[model samples]
Target: MPKTLIVVYADGAAHPGDIAVGLASWARCVFVTEPADHTRAMEPLLSQFGPVITTGSAAEAAARLRPYVPDGLVTYSERALRFAAEVASALELPFHDRPTVGRLTDKWLQRDALRAAGVDTVRCHRIATENDWARAVADTGLPAVLKPAHGGGSRNTFLVTDVGEGLELVRGLLSEERPGLVAGGALVLEEYLPGRDLGPFGDYVSVESIVRQGQVTDIAVTGKFPMVPPFRETGRFWPSPLEYEEEERARELARRSVEALGVRSGLTHTEIKLTPDGPRLIEVNGRLGGGINELSVRALGLNLIELAGRTALGEAVPTPDFYRGRAYFQLFHPAPRRASTLLGIEGVEEVKRNAGVTLYRPYAKAGARLPGGVQTQELDIVMGEAPDVTELATIAKEVEATLRYRFAFADEPGAAVTESSVTGAELGAL
Candidate 1:
């Protein structure tokens, strides 16, 4: 019988489509997801690969998955990481141990461990009350960041330029109902590190790696597009345009940061800021970088999800020569205004006709409600490949110039169409 792999599925999981394809190629794939997800779009898409099991809770999912005696267990959800770690432990399977997963998932714990290990990291404090928030500001000084201690997608993250803003944001967070991954009323306040003042690409970048048996192999450095501020990512460019020495320094920092966190085996994504002083860790993720799998496959000629699955199954992972090319993924957001309905998209055909264009996917449906001011909830994504950074920049500009979005508000009868212009310089390609 073929080996069995159990995947904990969630909406917005890192590379779910690619992960399913990767696992199904090597093992008998079984997906465990929420019942609601099963009834939604994910079910049909995932059903193409293998059987899916719907459960109400993580514990119940584990109970159902136990009988399978899965050879490997994996999850791309930040909320599911701890649960998956527990299930893996019960099954005696290879995984980043529970403690390691905790440190990776909890931003506060991550800061503590990295600092304790003498890793270069910013000072951060946990806030659960107004008093704690004031104390954090007094200690960390002005221009700090306020964010959930265990949150992803930049939800509820805010940049506190002053005490009043910080206090308001913290009070709101304290009163809001907490997500499963977050401790009730808990938030993290950290000293903000400014990135290089280059255009859209911030001074920070993400390092993607696959770790096996306590060894980490750095695979790629991904550059970021200028954020929506208060800390939401807009897009990313792969094989960062960093010079050889800077790239090496980043790799060393990533390896050290991962080692400090005690990650044994899994895919790791580490974000670090290229500060004027040096590289400092932002956070570490115990899975592939979100939206990076497809970019990796296109630029490096590697399937990160497959590599992660093979590592989980205790199989030898082969390191292949990466393709010497550049690729970028940009997000389109309904910013400046919210839309009650997405009427249509124009110039998609022209974008597809561009030589460098590879993938263009729109997430918004005709009747979908699009909330403004959040880049993380972008309505569409465009990815392309080119022989070098220059060509990649050209492609990005062309796509941005060609595509247009038409939206209608509840009070409006006619759709409002607008063309978005994004220049290469504004994209911040290093």
Candidate 2:
């Protein structure tokens, strides 16, 4: 019998929709969705697959997909993870177990498991109330990391330097709107260990694998560009550059984490900081890494989404060998100011014309508003690939320097960048 693959996305509008397209090859059917703004560019390619059904709600979409009885289910966001599990259960399709999904989504729960396994990580505790907050401080001490116990892409993550900052951050989080997305309205605080920020120079290691029948397979390690965090991902590069010892430590950490979390199936994206203490497990997501995967999937010449589907569906995935080395992607944001229009992207053509640079994303439209809060993602002006870290960083700098944005309002036009503007510590964050 032909297999069916169902992909659940929050805002269905994904560019270069290869996941949907890839599943279409083997699946007997395919279904996808986005919220109100359905921006899935893969819709055009859906016809090549089986019937494509678009819906408003995952439940509604899942109901529509019921007849197909999909063999596999996969998703990107937490919302979609819940919906995918629901659809899998409704149709009895193979999927990541409920417990596994919970462990993956809930940060505190995952940390508890890691702690139990004696995993070396930053010290952390959960805060359920005012009392819990106070207790957490006493336990972990001041100048720690605070983030929603169950959140992603560094949403509401704060690095509190002192007690006052911690108190205010907690108060703001508590008072702020609760989307009720996760199970609890709790906060997770951890001892903040200062380290070299990995986003700028070092590779963001993504150890990818497909787990099936309580076993993992098809593991692939890739490198990524340094992320400007709290939810900004510039791009990724394949074949991470790691010292022999560090790479081994990361592999061991990833292996232990998968075992500790009891991840039976699906792809897991783990982010860790290589601290002096060793490979400190930052956090693990039991799914493909967004934006990062965009480059890996292309560079590695592999179909991660498809491999994940096969694992979820209890099917065998084709053997995957790491592809050509040294592929990179960059995300360009309004670094100093909100660029309203392209006043000039100086070396864009030169870079494009260069042999090694592969692809580009003109995230902002010509007349689009300048970037600030919500339009931050759109503020990214360019994305392209290079050969190695040196080339990648050089091109990234070149691309950053070339792009010029015409601001909507004329306050001072731009923020002055000083030596202090990008201090040693600040560079780590970039």
lDDT of 1 by residue, 211-317 (tens): 88898888888877666555666678876767778877988999999999999888899998988777788899998778788777666667788788778888897
lDDT of 2 by residue, 230-281 (tens): 3344455565666667776787788788878888777777776666566678
Segments in model 2 whose C-alpha atoms lie over 4 Å from true places: 12-16, 32-64, 179-184, 197-200, 229-231, 322-324, 334-347, 370-378, 381-387, 406-430
TM-score of each: 0.87, 0.80
Candidate 2 has an lDDT of: 0.62
Candidate RMSDs in order: 3.9, 4.9
Go through the candidates in order and give each one's C-alpha lDDT: 0.74, 0.62
For candidate 1, which ten residues in a row score worst on lDDT?
421-430
lDDT of 1: 0.74
